[model samples]
Target: MKKLIHTLLAGSLLTTCLATTSAVNAMTVSPQNWWAGMQNSSLQIMLHETEIAKQQWYLESYPGVELKSITKTDNANYAFINLEISPNAKPGKLLFKNRAGDQFEYPLLTRDKQSAERQGFDSGDTIYLINPDRFANGDSSNDTVQGMAEAASPSERGGRHGGDIQGIINALPYLDELGVTQLWLTPPLENNMASYSYHGYAITDFYNIDPRMGSNELYHELSAKAKQHGIGLVMDLVLNHFGSEHEWMKDKPTTDWINFNGDFADGKHATSHARQTIQDPHASEFDKRQFSDGWFVSTMPDLNQRQPLLATYLIQNAIWWIEYADLSGIRVDTYSYSDKAFLADWTKAIMVEYPNFNIVGEEWTSNPAIASYWQAGKINNDGYTSSLPSVMDFSLQESLIQALNEDESWNTGWVKVYESLANDFLYPNPDNLLVFADNHDMSRVYTELKQDLAKTKMAMTMLLTTRGIAQMYYGTEVLLDNTGSNDHGDIRIDFPGGFAGQKTNAFTGQGLNSDQVDMQQTITTLLNFRKNSPAIAKGKLTHFSPKQGVYSYARISEQQTVLVFLNKNTTAKTWSLDYMREVLGNHKSATALFNKQKVKLTKPLTLPAMSALVLVIE
Candidate 1:
């Protein structure tokens, strides 16, 4: 392995010989490595080094790969090499020699056997959201890396904690037993910021994993191990912006690499929050430009996706992860904040390669019409065609919270949820939406329901059985709350007993109180039952309007019908069977899975106060 980097002064090709032999030092090649036998033979290899453009290089042909073209960017340090890898190509190295006698090699490994056939997470999967920095601590040694800016400070809300990839890998069995089929971890990629980098949003390196979290090899290990436990890993990434410490910041590939507040020289950008401008009909060009081009914060520099090379780089980065880590899905942060055209193209490119893969965009809008515009087959009036398979159901999430908290009235309590679902027509494929009661960014579901266990259970039941992909934050099952404040650090609390010598361990159930244990068991039972329920997985849902303080819905499939009822009354309410006769049809009796009791459809069933009932009918 050559570690020494040799470079010549500012000069054209053959100005000087820096090294007599090939060297693999001082160069960043992304994707750092690639696989042979890909569906698309074309590969774009991006390279950045000290005055690398001035160097001369030629491809030493190998069995599977062929050199196509080397396009130098505006920046002298950057170069884009295009290659054609034929299907007949096998795993090997494609050697190259520069004019100055320095040699470099690109490894072409065999693709995973299931690369193209890999299935992404979908509506049938239950996603367990983990904020790794706050989730658990498996390896204490990686708590602080030497070169990293932020070190481990588990006690602080926004400070880095020791929770790494191993932490997540250690809790696989716990998650599996909880019945979560998919794992959605917030970005584990490197942030390398000065502070407050625990959230992993301000990424400094796209090709490498956060050393504090783990290594690139370990990320692969986690994904592989997760598959064994029947869990699919969904990688969360930010394409819109990157941390100021990113390598490209100091030496951008082009003049327009990033939007510097429409002024690149001095760098003092103005507008930061402009997410709504993309969909606003009255939005001006200036506002739209600012929204897509403005930085998220002074620490995060907004990338210019309009730059063709930059756009391609972002697209390839996502594809590289799916191929390298065997990821089942992608959760793009601030989806609509990026260039709209670039988003459409970016989603289309990935879907084309992995036709079965799922990518859920985070369009955090409460309006159904705006949220629907990003989903596939939306047929927007703007004539935009988005290939995204799913979107985070922000509209439904908000409605569910409001529905459970307000008093019963027109568009108030249960009607809020009913009305939210009624807007399903606006969405192209409502069933594919990603639904959840709360996430790392918001108040915990327990806190949102004001610590009311019954209301919490009702919200959980509604989300779990609804017609969309269901997701739950890590500490939700144990009643994690951020009651007094909305600080994210409070919302994304560290798991009890995640560290050594801790007293309360949610995993082993060693020190949890009765209420915590019960909530955990409740979630486990509901998720386990939902895992095999065809009626809840892919069934057609029909919900009746909330009436007399009672809300009911039925998930109907060819073989079974799953019925759910929620009573908002403070007092136990007896519901008549006559009202639901149309949905009941010929089923004489239904088994209540919650208590394992059978209820006769011919007779009225009394529901406990503020209760949720789940019944399976054949």
Candidate 2:
């Protein structure tokens, strides 16, 4: 009887072992081949398990690889292992050994050296900014989350329209023909909010990309594909705050992890505080603290960048993405809201790690002095050194608005842009300024200008031909507009025909109004022209306000010289040659870029009203 009972138990144990082996074999790993987006000699490997605690798993690289550290995360199901690859470690499969002697193999690909350096894109490139959820709905299956609140349909202005990273990737050829060289999608990081999370500003997880948009792996793939088409990717980073539902809020890491935790503080207004503190002779420490540390919104918890650990975490998160995505640059959102010291340190560290990388900060100050102060080489009266290389030219935006809305008189209106350009001396490197007519935060450029096509064209003409770097918000080329509503939802409208069921498609130039098509063609022509024109890329800028409502500038290099003239008058105005004779000395003949007409200038040239002219002088 004892022998028979022992045989039965042994048979049951063998059956259980075989079942486990079969289950392991049935499991599948996606994205069979893995390529590190950005990497160096040192690598951090994160492993996740559905059943067993990751701490029970032992991770070891190839025979010649060196282990730096093996760390268990707060969640026992994940493990973080740091390893140093051998200088000649042949790229192969990474083996993870579990306590049960079960092994999982993941293939690894070595870094592409040429591609890594290509990550840093140039200013000559046009950036298309899309609010993903409002751009297109390539995949509708992932529209609603299981337990999350359901968003309204695409027709609803504020609804989550199911636009994903795949949609943008699908429409790459459209962007490419539009002469876009870089794509800046608003923060794709996870935002687990119940409503209005479509904007992606309130991030819940820094490490994971929003599943609604796509997986983190898909994002890396998008970057790789973008690079293949001569396009770069610029990540939008938010360091000031995190979503209130962020995991850290549930269980505080430290008492000082966030400012005014649980309890909300009425955030101080930005303009006065940011501008006054920098300009004030006796700015209070308390006031400055409130300006930078206050929460942006009740739903967004402000991060205490002053905290050492929190600061380090934020910095490392940014570096991890830069190295992980092989990104071209970063456009920091709400840049002024973060601690000034921390911002300086963060930028400095990033610049040190990637010497040639560039970062543009969103310091939305309309004053040139205030904007210039944040740039790296600004000579401030107060000894403030910023590691920031570029700042959004809010002054230029103000100038554009004034030029469009105001009268054409010399002392009053449309010449504000010319006058603003004269103030470029205030900035140490004016060429580095990111000049834009509009962005995601504000009303669409078309809406702001009251849907005036001529003014829109003028804005694009200046943006493309100007001295500084230029950025065009998505949909601007197609003249996308949100007529009455000034809210963000309306501003970030759905791109026409982006969805599968849509009757009109912007990609094929179908279902577009005549004005929209004209704007698209104009922008495309100018951008492609600028791409091959060395005269516009690296040229010396010279300007003269020959008269009211008439402004002209020349960008000259050793190989080529190009001149631009803006005439805002109702009638054709003749610009006297005497006023610009010194600058145009020995240049008698010029060819217009748009019309391809050549003219000999002896006395004065007639510039039409509400028109811009670009001349190539040989």
Candidate 3:
């Protein structure tokens, strides 16, 4: 009898252990739980669980959590659960359960609680744009995937370099010290393309973060850390197209889901003829249709934003990221490629949702008139309206390139840039323009200037002290080079010290040339100076002509005033203050922001050749 009791006791213990193990195993996380990264009210959670087929899956939360509905798939293994969370729902863990008593937990991050009315960004901040894969490889283990055809190699221009979000997060201190207030990363979404995915313009899954860069959760962590350092996050959004290998492309929901369903063609040239039509006085319908409905590349299938369902999905996806990652702004890629009406609607809805947030569109035109038409507040005679708050200052880019490359001719001297600014009257809000010399699509500014250290410094001085918002491409300050080619791959070189085995470290300022060091120091000095100056942010700008290849401007406000002089001549020139008197406002003593030297501006200010200066009046 005692032996029998011992057997029964041992059996009971074994049973309990098996039950606990099974319960723990049942609580598994979905590998493709993309919705888990979201942080908004309307959330659609897609689940794949074969074991829970017979059981009902429901979301449970504390009071104020509103469950929309539970939808089960025909396969009985998938669930599409929708939930509308209350604004007051506590930011914490959300538990999901099944009828069999299995449970899993996911986090609900803090939503942006600020109202939509607060919409204005100060000009003192500098935006740093980075191409993730080439920036730094914080995690190299995920560089090459099993199915991906491209191999990981730094020497190969088109191969993946494995830069991840963690690399940038780790370099926050370096960026902060460099006077960067905003970080704009290229789209980190999944790109399952076969080759040349380093640029990240073609997205395969809008909701899933690329595993090569780390999981979606890592991106959220990066945003949180960035906010702690007072750095705003600017997500690069691509609403125009998706990779050809996208899962949805295999079985499109509708025939009109893509621009040329099943039939592919190259995109039309982005010329005035293509864009100005649709309402042109004499435009062929064929031209207009081709302009609006053409593929960007054979690999990038153009999305049909004109379709209401697709439009809503794209808009909602953008909002989800903003609320999820607490993004400060969005840099919409290929903004002109999408449907015009749909683009207008997308911008309007986003503004309605977060009026305070900023959206900068890339129009990519060298004409100020063409670029200004896309910015908000432009009164077009054609009765068209755009909700975009800001646009890339491509006109300024052209002027800067010209000013650096051309000689001091009477018609095209350093005054090219000065003249470009003079045309700011065409823009509804010139200060809202995103000014940059080079970006991901363009050659490196240093390479374009032929590695002229002085010219690069002058460009930086003007970009930081100018009247518009400044965006500096990553590695610009360090004189990062892409010398021989203008291809996208060449432009995005890997950041130093981002990977584990790198010998040189950019973060700690090691292995840098003297010119690079000087450039880095110059940018840091100028940006830090602008950071505390309210005059540069909201002051009125006034400019004067090129005398002896010199151009000058002054920003004045009630509390503070600043003057900037650009001298491009071979010899030093004395810039007359007579024309800038209107904005200088009777200031006699001027202080140099970079060198901290005091000067009496009662006489003409002497500016060195190929140099720029920022003078603050006390």
Candidate 4:
């Protein structure tokens, strides 16, 4: 075999190989590197080049390692090499060569100590979600690149504002001080689209970070730096689709790689967005296909996860990221849109590899039944099983908004929230659900509450103390609002101090108004208090029905008990503790979290109107 000359090309290593005596072409391999001793010994490495399949390949003899097979696709440019590394395999370079004397090196690196035993964020953590482009710009030089499709336009709502991984790393101290235990940024992978790519849903390169955002090394650096601040990183991943501008669009990998044979057919192939069809007993095949196989938009080509090769590719891609980036968790975007079986396999593979790791799927449904069906322990009537550890609580998000915005009524207001939580019986593990007031996709909670600071505090206080893993949007602490417009650009507005020319800087508390400071203080207090609360972490929740515009609940644990009262009334009211006798057992007195005053639990508690009161009992 002849040695191949290697050259660095566009952040990825490309090898110039001889496929034939007269032909020399470049090939790129994915998953930059892999680690030994992974739970699964099997590895499927993909090679992309001109007529890559034409060459016969073999792996150099290595102890405890064997090349199982090489699968070629319908397209001449792609080849999938399957290899198995034994449990005792050590870190070393594996040299692979073809019959035409072309060779390349693949590295099997060492795993971090106790990597598989890494703990995922749970009820004990407060996840802060950030839109990197809107967060801060630590590096302004990479704002525009020679090959990137879009330029940085700070004024344009949809244009890239140049928020990179360094920006997130720079704000780690602020996040840690605010008691944020985990950070979930929108997909940091390369979008590389012509427009509106700042949101990061349209993924172009799964293996690489966007150069305009940062490099792969920088992303790894982010995980390391964030860990030092006691923060875990949760990567947002898009598996159902890819940006249309991806190289796969230019050169077909296989006939079945993309759904609908890579044709949108003028919006006729668009998804119905009816997520219910997945669990509907009588749902038709056509409806299921229309919802699952249809494209999200013309710019994003839906992937054909039903294809076995593609299924393996996505599953391995997710695992590669977890091992490569030292990720704490994964938040899958458009989770249900992918093939159900593939999702099961994808999630199961990761869970099997890292039993302690967590993955939350975005179901985006207001129905508890639909959302709970995707959770791990659900005994689905359809005989379907899911390995997903967590599901987003869209039902609570919608109900909480309504509960705060609507007037007091028997079936509305606080009752909406009460009924929503009552549906917790549907989930196998209610505490594992991801609960949040607002996220990157919707209107800010402050704006939803009509910029009412009191209501905003109540909403956040209730959310933080609720019985689930909590996630907060980037600027909720300082009241970032998109009052008049519901546009995505407006919803994901720039962080004040994160960029230049901003009068206010949230990081330093510069030029902040009274309400902003108040909200900030309130969030900091709740988050900090929640950090050490045993009741909030693993306690049993007991709540009372809404009465007289007040909703009350208690988190009971062996070490601590917490009482929360949310009053929606416009005036203070005396709340009876008679109904909470079972939960308040022998707790005569407790200290209020907000006011730091001792209150007798036996007496009728005075609940301030439109406020949340949290009491801790030792």
Candidate 5:
């Protein structure tokens, strides 16, 4: 009877607790667990409960971790506890006690061996960009999770089509066979919004992966399998705003947790343009405030980094993910919209922890001058210094595509590529930049070239052999295009083999047309050759001015040199080997890279019309 009464009271008290406080806030903490043996000894853990700060909760003594202080915010529901962990802290759980004598356990895990010294993605790696939700469906049972709002609607283009982490794991062999060394997946964090959660930009949970996709353990499994295939994982992170349904939004850590709160009568303020004023020297304070303080959308609340605690929380969240997932690289979305000072500190902290790591920021602008300003070593007159080592080369993507589609002329044709490279002096480390022909946000390169195969090949050749890191979208191998519409849903369509019952399976080459097969072959050959070609990987690039209907360039290293020529005319032309004598030298013999034929370079080489020829000068 005594045990029965205790159990009945416990159940009754739990029911009352749920009625009073929402399920998420009753008893939990952000970053549910942390790893031991981190180089950084200081760790801040945030706790959430119903007026927990006012209630009595004392920390129990634990080994290897010292309770520094319990910091409370203006809101009584939240508390920030700072802990100083010793370098030798063992992987164990720390206990805390409530007034009712209830104990809460927070687990501390051990870091992987030599985790701090892991190498990141570099120029030598060709990145395969995948939208996980649209990639493949490996498991049918996980199509619609129980608690999730959105159901899998395969008929709708934008609906969730049952692609999960298992789908990506299933396609690893195909990716590896294609010579892809890195996988860059868009944000996989939970977005519990009722509608349009397929894109995953709006995050509702930081600590857990979406159940519809998979569990946290499954993500770790995917990472481990990817490493076995000699592939690195790059995570796309968005730090600007989060979904309104985030746990903290119900009762913010403080009144100022979100920006633009209580600023308008209708609470429907406009999203900030956040445009050129960020780079302007004479911009007004209003512009800066509006840019940094405004929300992304009504449903996505912008976080205020001006609050010191919020700033630290965001930084710690990033570090946690890196350690948790063993990530190789991070691609920050809306990189320039966040607080400039916070971004500098965030990058510095992560780099200090892992010196070999690489982070590329997404600044979708076509101006090289603007893009280079955020690079690490650029000397800006404004006296601003950035720790970001790499940025996406949107200018090169625009120039290369525009150059390929236009006619050869004095100011047109291949001059774009030459001039684009001429501006390389603007960036501190241009080699670390990510160069691509087209990504999810833009039209496919094939579409941009008006479905011309020769033009497509020329652009692909430049992208693969260019100076910076190269990235290929998921369906680019099979000529994924949105000729009639530019909607993101259309652009990020389901991969041919990703879904079941599809007529064409790009992976197995089933139901594929000749053009798709040939394109895939072309990319596979180029990528495999590049994997072993040191000259193309880290070589010094030298190119002559686009002249006489030929745009030619050479990648030279100590061991070998590769000469690439693109003909811009409708008729076949003979390219003169005489002008390239300095780089080519008196090398009388050469081998064609495409066909692997030993050709004598003693005289002018015959070139096909509107074709690309790569020759290894011997």
Candidate 6:
């Protein structure tokens, strides 16, 4: 075996020299290993070492595998090895040698049985979004590690709180009991930033998990154990930009690797956050470039995906994580900030590899037209084709908050939500969209609704029974709120009982107040029932317009029917059922999901003020 040494040099690609004759000691390769028999026969391995481009290497007699070519960039330190692995190839080690007799072996592993056929989270599953660093502190030892810039500061809201992967693994039973079917943790990849690294969005290393969180093996363990509890794992992916502290920033693979030639120009190249430019036919080229190529912040340098090599690296990095972590789905961050052409190709490659899988992108726009433009089957006016199966429904989320906060009127209150849902015609597959009231980036649902438990419950009820897949931010059931502050750290506050010195322990139910307990029970009941309800999961959604301070909708299927009434009234009122005859369809009496009392559909239903009423017909 030859020794290939890797270093943090600009475009340095490792090439081994014979151990017997050369003194080279080690090397680094992106996607260090691969699986045989993948749908995509081609693979590109990025080798980074000193003067690696000058080495002439050849494959050592591998069956069903061929070294198609070795391409080098302007930087001699970087080399890209492209290989074609046929379907007949089996899992084993493939050897390579240069003319100087230096040799190295790459392992091609076997895929897991039924790996490609894995089912992604959909309307049937309730996804729980967790900020891993704030969720729990199962492992305090790793909170402060050697060589890491930041140390744990549990008292400071924005500081690291020592939560690790083991904490999530420990909370599996708790999550299972809450009836959550899927977990979408914020990215646990190595941020390696000096500050505000707890949110895990600024990725410094794509291939490895952060040691502060856990190892790559431990993350795989979380996936496996989560499966045991009947939950799927959805990884959070970032492709638009990376932490400025990343090694790539110091030693770029190519001159054009970073957007604007690795210069932020004192925020001159910052994004306008004008996502609408992507779908706007009249959008100027300058506006489009500013939105796409601009850096998010000085600390997050935008990636130049137009560079073909960097594009391939990102696409392969996503696939590698999916295979390595046994992921069931992915939630892309800042989806529209990257180059549009690259976004199409990247999504296409992932879907082609796993046709049954799903990927949801975060467009973060309240405009349904712009959001729907990215779904897989939409026929855009500009002839843009997208392979994205799911997108976050920011329109509904924004309207729901407004509806609950405002007074009832023709153009206000519940009408806002009704009009929002009326725009569903804009989406190709509305049911495949991700519906959530709040996530990590914004304020918590409870806080946004002014810590009103009734309003919060109404929001959760609406989401869980809606047409699209539902997602809940962690601590929502217990009414965690970030009142008077919109800080990311405050929004992602520590989960009670997850850490020490807290009066409340949501896990053990030890110090919870009545409101917390009631909220928790409400979510549990709705989630468990939703888990089995064909009506809520795959039914047709038919909602009536706002009438007399009430917004009502019905999810009807052959097996069951669910009726939801959200009343924002200050006083209990009798809601007439005459207008919903089309959906009610001969149903007489129904059972209330919360209290299990039989409701007579034949008479006017009495709706509790400022609360969500859910009834089921069987």
Best-matching candidate per lDDT: 4
Q: How do the predictions measure up, each by TM-score?
A: 0.95, 0.83, 0.84, 0.98, 0.93, 0.96
Task: Please tell me which model should have the higher TM-score, number 1 or number 6.
Answer: 6
* Global lDDT scores for all candidate models: 0.85, 0.74, 0.75, 0.91, 0.82, 0.90
lDDT of 6 by residue, 1-618 (tens): 454542332222223433437454344677778899899999999887778788897899889999999989988878899999999999998887778666677889899988788788888999999999999988889999798778888889889999989999999999999999999999999889999898898899888888899888889999999999999999999999999899888889999999999999999999999998987879999999999999989999999999999999999989888888899999999998999899999999999998889899999989998999999999999999999999999999999999999988899998988998999999999999999999999999999999899999999999999899999999999999999999899999999999878899999999899999999999999999988999988999999889888889999999999999998888998888999899988999999999999999999999988889999999
The segments of candidate 4 whose C-alpha lies over 4 angstroms from its true place after superposition are 1-3, 7-24
Flag clash pairs in model 1: 22-103, 64-89
Q: Regarding TM-score, does 1 or 4 come out ahead?
A: 4
Q: What value of lDDT does candidate 4 attain over all alpha carbons? A: 0.91
- lDDT (10s digit) by residue, model 3, range 1-618: 001011112101101111342242222222212232232456555454443346676777566566688655444444556667666666676676666565555555553446334343447678899998988776778787676555577778887888888888888988888888888998988887888877788788787777787777788889889978888889999988888888557756456778866457344432223665644668787787677677767888878898765676687778767766778889999787788889888898888777777899988778787778777788977787989999989888889888887888787867788888988988998988999989999998899989888888888788887888889999888888888888778888777777677676678888887887888888888878778777777777777777667767778777788888877777887766777667766678988887999988788878887788888885
**Two-way TM-score contest, 3 vs 6, winner:** 6
- In model 2, which regions exceed 4 Å deviation? 1-109, 115-119, 147-152, 265-275, 500-503
Which lDDT value does model 6 have at 233?
97
* Pairs that collide, model 3: 136-163
Candidate whose TM-score is highest: 4
Model 5: which residue pairs collide?
Answer: none
Instruction: Tell me the lDDT of model 4 at 365.
Output: 96
Query: How do the candidates rank by lDDT, highest first?
Result: 4, 6, 1, 5, 3, 2
Error of 4 at 475 (Å): 0.3
Candidate 6 lands at a TM-score of: 0.96
Better model by lDDT: candidate 2 vs candidate 4: 4
lDDT of 1 by residue, 1-618 (tens): 223343322111112223326643366677766778877788887878888888777898677677888989778998888888899998887776776666766667778787888888877889999999988888899899899888888778888878889999999999999999999999998899999899999999887888899888889899999999989999998998888888888889888888863343344454546666767789898887767777767788888898988888898889989998899999999998888899999999999889999999998888888888899998877798999999999988999999888888876898988988999999888999999999988999999899998898889998999899999999888888899989888888889867776898999999898879878988998899888899988899899999988889999898889989999889998888788887888999999987899998898898889889988997
For each of the candidates, the C-alpha root-mean-square deviation to the true structure, in angstroms, is 4.0, 7.1, 7.5, 1.7, 3.9, 2.8
As a whole number from 0 to 100, the lDDT of residue 584 in candidate 3 is 63
lDDT of 2 at 318: 75
Q: How accurate is candidate 6 locally (lDDT)?
A: 0.90
Model 1 scores worst on lDDT over the 10 consecutive residues at: 8-17
